[model samples]
Target: MQPCVLTSTGGAPVAARFHAPPGAVRGAVVIGGAMGVKQDYYAHFAQWLSEQGYLVASFDYRGMGDSQRGSLRRLRADLFDWTDDFDTVIAEALARSGGAPLYLIGHSLGAQLPGLLKHRDRVDGLLSVAAGSGYWRDNAPQLRRMVLYFWHVLVPVATRLFGYFPGRKLRKVGDLPAGVVMQWRRWCMNPRYHVGAEGAPVREKFEAARFPVVALSITDDELMTERGTQVLVDCYANAPRRVERIAPADVQARRIGHFGFFRDQFQSSLWQRALTQLQAFRSPGETRDPADGISSRVAPGLLTAH
Candidate 1:
């Protein structure tokens, strides 16, 4: 992987990395990182995809990771602006692919923002890992109390006093821009998530998404419960969607939590399964159904909007 920087349409310098295969490329992929997570977290996964003959790009949002130029106390980025960052990266991936099909591997907050993509039609398909609504009530039962504390206490207090979320100092997640954290808190507090938080225009945009999406939810994920995952998938009212809930035992592991999917430890078992599903979309007129040829056990179809 080589270091790169992307200039968003809005002019923010987004930090990124690119992985290219030696031989012919089958497809181009843009790996979008989760909230408070840096692009480097997905570096190994991106390299693996490149080895499989795919050109892959992994990027960090403007206010996070290498993209941030200075102190978070002065930055003022919001979650919606992330759509612009994604647009820039996707455009770069498409340009590099020389017109090869482009796919997205979006994790957590990475997955939720795709509906806002201005070039949604350009995407061949999306693979959403551990994607779900952030509504606290919809989280895993065991984590709900913690979620409440985070939503009601930590976020507000920290953002108010520090001018940004001091997640890194608190050892919660990672440091976040004030606007991003507050906006996220608002969405998570709403039952409808971003749809409710942003109102009708956002809802319409989500309904406009018509691509195929495969949402992978881990049963052991303490952050997102089954209902949390389902709620986000349901928002894509016009997408052909499938939800696959995998238990750790199914993969011969004791635990695969919210962040484990991208770890190198699962590169052979879980990661390979994801690659198969992604590669399935490489050929024209290929099966678009998420269930076809995927090794992971498929849960009941979540929401398939016609």
Candidate 2:
């Protein structure tokens, strides 16, 4: 793995790890999960993709992981900053790989950010794991949503006064900024805000650059709900998209939720499946390990527009 850096539109420096095939590269970029997520968690998957003939680039968004630091905290970052960081990473990946066709594998919130990047046309395809369209659906219950909203309102004040919120100690909730939290809430409550790459707002000119897309969701994901996943599917403006659901019992190694898909004991299984699907699109006849293939049960299908 080679370490590298790139500058975001915000002027923040980004850090990334690149894995190249021994021969000429196929193409792919593997993005880690949200806030404070480390690429080591997906290290095995990175190496595996490389071995399968892909030049995979994995990175830390600015203000997170090995990237250079700025004045922001995770919970404090808004969507715009994240989008800029993603574009920087993609640009770096293009430069390093000699500007080959690029496929993207984005996990959780990271999945959404890539689609939001200004130059998404550079992408040849997308694989989104545990994708969320930014809303909770009915799972949060009206009362709980209100309480969470109120808590989000206080997060900024509390962090400012106390220097930080409790971090990730809150059960099942991610460590995030009050501003990001509120922005997400606003998107979720409004009928407009889309989740994952499906929800990100794109410029009209870039809308025609539809590449093949695969969205996989796990059953019983506490952080991402089926309803939310369905909503995301409904909003996608792309053709030839697939959405697959994985049951916990089928999750080979560890029972994965939102974060666990890339971190669980059975990560190898998930990677194998996803890699197979990705490789299937590389050329007309490239084949990858089915063990690396996404579950047959959770396979993505043709995505219909609403």
Candidate 3:
């Protein structure tokens, strides 16, 4: 895997890893993951895609992972910042590959970011893994949800008021960027800011997107409920679209809950399915579509929707 850095207009450095597939490369895929998650976390998954004859580039957004950190003191992380950062990644990837068929694989927030980049024509396909409408209605019990909301409001306030706010330990992850955490707070409290669902009209920035799309969500994702996934599915009004759902039990014993989908233990489980969806679009003489995003394979599974 070769390492590269994309410098964005915002003066942030985006770290990227590029893996050339064995033999002749059939296609290329750019991967993006959830918040506070690093690109290295998907190393096994990237290797798997590379083995399947794909040149894959996985990268960390500015202020996250190996890239430069943002001003945490100001709590300024926003989707626009990451979107611009991703724009640089796409430009560099295309320039380096010389216009190879490109696909996108975005998990969680990464999945949603591309929706904001619909005007960019650098991708041929898209795979939205565990991407959902940004509503926290079913995130937890009413009491727990209320507590979370209260904390969302209180923490930022206290942080500004007293310079520090109590934070929960992220699940095996690092600290959340202040901007990202604050944006999440606004998103959770309102359903309109949700992705892949009814909300603000497609921004003028994304109207250029007309490529084929596939959005998938897992049933057992503790962070996003089935309803939230459906909301995302409903947002895509374009043709050549497909939506897939995976119940936790369907993923064998792997328990592909949220982050588990890309983890090593569940490679053959969920990752295989994702790959199959990608391969389905690839043919011997076919060039890549600019909207198709993911290129993973799928193995046997019994994912039934409730």
lDDT of each: 0.84, 0.61, 0.65
lDDT of 1: 0.84
Q: How many clashes in each candidate? A: 0, 12, 24
Measured against the true structure, the TM-scores of the candidates, in listed sequence, are 0.92, 0.77, 0.80
lDDT (10s digit) by residue, model 3, range 1-306: 999887876567789998888876667788877766789888989989999888888888776768855444544556667777777777766665555667788888777677666334656677888876666664534334454645466647755653323243323234555555566666656664544232445533333454456777776676766666655544444324556778777866646777778877777777888788777655444554335543222211212112
Per-residue lDDT for 40-133 in model 1, tens only?
Answer: 8888889988999889999999988889888889886888788899999898887777776778899998899999998787777789999899
Runs off by more than 4 Å, candidate 2: 68-77, 138-156, 159-179, 194-209, 251-254, 282-306
* Clash pairs detected, candidate 1: none
Report the Cα lDDT for candidate 2.
0.61
- Please give the TM-score that candidate 2 achieves against the real structure: 0.77
Candidate 1, which segments miss by more than 4 Å at Cα?
Answer: 282-306
Using lDDT as the measure, name the better of candidate 1 and candidate 3. Answer: 1
Candidates sorted on TM-score, descending = 1, 3, 2
Residue-wise lDDT of candidate 2 within 198-235, one digit each (tens)? 24345332244465667788876766666666555444
Worst 10 residues of 2 by lDDT: 291-300
